[model samples]
Target: MKIDLSFKIAVLLVPIILFDTLAYAGIIPEKKRIIFKGDEQQQVLLIANTNDYPILMQTWIDNGNTQNVPSATVSPFIITPPMSSLAAGEIKGLRIIYNKQKTLPNDKESAFWINLYEVPPTSKENKLVDNVTVAMNTQIKLFYRPTPLANKPEEKTLVTQLSCYGKAHNLEITVSCKNPTPYYISLSNIELNLNNHTYHNETQLDMMVPPFSDNSYRINVDSTNVPQQVNVEYSFVDDKGDVHGVKSTIRID
Candidate 1:
């Protein structure tokens, strides 16, 4: 459904706050992230409203900034029907159209964020009364894959090219992964077992290592001695956001 101009203006005026607490969202994205191929001019995203009440969803593409609203954000893509309403148990599709005016890097993948602002129906009777109306803003990763990279190997095949190692400094140990491929690696449940002791990474559980880059996580160790053999167990997400677990022996230096 089309949102009126007045309501659309109000949504833009509302302060867009990024909350750390994740609440149940009435509007749910069908996929974890969107992979936009350079060959495709437009892509469609399916969002479903699972709540009993209707909700207004405003979408925009931003360059990794969650604070930027639809009016102020600059992106190469524009979402069709930026603002629309969904009835209860309704499914709607939002089309992302790429503007050829802007130029993005063609060698590697560029990342952006697609924001979904969900606004609930406010009561007219409680308009003048003091009430806390909480609105949820969800952000999903949008990767622009150039046409040339399509012929390259997939993430699962390139996963073997990643090298994991460990380093010891004083009472802490650092675990590092070197990604030599052109695909972004999203890893989770990273664990290092040494001498039957499990060490969890201090970094975020869901870590995305950029293409051709290295990410290191520090873990506290009782001794400064770095073992020669360290068993590393981790899970990496593919392009489709599916997780695959891997176990390998890493060296310590």
Candidate 2:
């Protein structure tokens, strides 16, 4: 990642909210997530400046750490034009080239993050205070697909392959799911029905299960009567960020 202090950019891990006013980031990526094939030499990401004013942009690749700065992170991929200035309503492509020095897992898919920093232009009136502008940082998931997995079924199809089971302990019921596919599965809107009762919450079960991994969530129930079986309903986010639903039944273990 290249840093240009001349722009007087101040990077923050979280969005800056000044009193009642919110600082909106002007840059938008064309895709919600990126899939990079090992056979390809490079992957390109197109971003646009939606605001009426020009903004400075900085990009970097990290190992899924939200607190990692550009200089502290290391990865096999390099983004071209790490730092640049975009005119208002201008669209530009960012080239991501793999260095090939780092050996990633061959059988399973690897994951990384693409971070973009948008620095708005400093107001002339604020320049008297040293011309510092707050920058908004955004990150998206990037999956590296080796050549071998290219022939397999799409990730969306693998949603049906997930196996789940339920177990009750004390006043809580635990639901565990196993993802056998090589691709990661991002789940949301998880709802479990047991004994004619539905257990669902806004912040309870949203998670991403890694390849060949298991994820479990516990839901508290008031009744001591635990059901022997459960119906699991969930939704997964695709590469395009569209949500799709899935239903399955699991027995208590």
Candidate 3:
């Protein structure tokens, strides 16, 4: 009886190559939204192994707005259990702690992201070993909020000065919300009412108006279908950095 050395080597390399590809693509985190505030700066994220086999999971944090991974020393936050194994149907906690010495500014909220890589565990079973292992990675948004010393203004006050309008000369529906107050405003649940039609675009719109800054969302519809007025409806984050369901409507002509 004889065995092929080349075939054995190719089988071994396949899993490794697949795992590396998975790590590059990333795994999905359990939590979609992560808010860090108050006296406690540490948060635990629970990740579950929904697969039938064991998986090795690794985690790291990066700037949410950027695709590049952050530097180890430059990142104030530390990810515990940078690498761990998860059994089938297992759930584990990944602790993320923020170093108080390198905390964010007290005036505004900052954004970061947690990414995970999941790889299949090697097995002695011939069937398991023969199967091609595919790895995956997921990234979730992480918000770091500074504990304000003084009470922040109400959401209405923070957004009362918001102005939403339409461009009579152009094909775009413009939503302009200027944050006149010293508090930051996260305008979510945004819907634009134009040309007697309502447009509900959830994914493409991420509006955050910083303190004393002018923020606007330009929605390109069509100049031929221009409306007489534009009505914008949105929700904002409260003093505790929690998004409030309260809705505010503004008009633009």
> By TM-score, who's the top model here?
1
Candidate 1 TM-score to native: 0.80
Candidate structures ordered by lDDT, highest first: 1, 2, 3
RMSD after Cα superposition, model 1: 7.5
Candidate 2, residue 99: lDDT: 81
Q: Write the per-residue lDDT of candidate 1 for residues 38-105, one digit (tens) a residue.
A: 89899888777766889998889998664577889888989878898999867777999989789877
Model 2 ranges off by over 4 Å: 1-24, 127-134, 169-172, 195-197, 201-206, 218-224
Model 2: what TM-score?
0.79
Give candidate 1's total backbone clashes: 0
> Candidate 2, clashing residue pairs?
none
TM-score of each: 0.80, 0.79, 0.65
What C-alpha lDDT, on a 0 to 100 scale, does residue 220 get in candidate 1?
Answer: 82
- Candidate 2 lDDT over residue span 91-163, tens digit each: 7779999888887887988888888888888877887786656788877788888999877575557878888
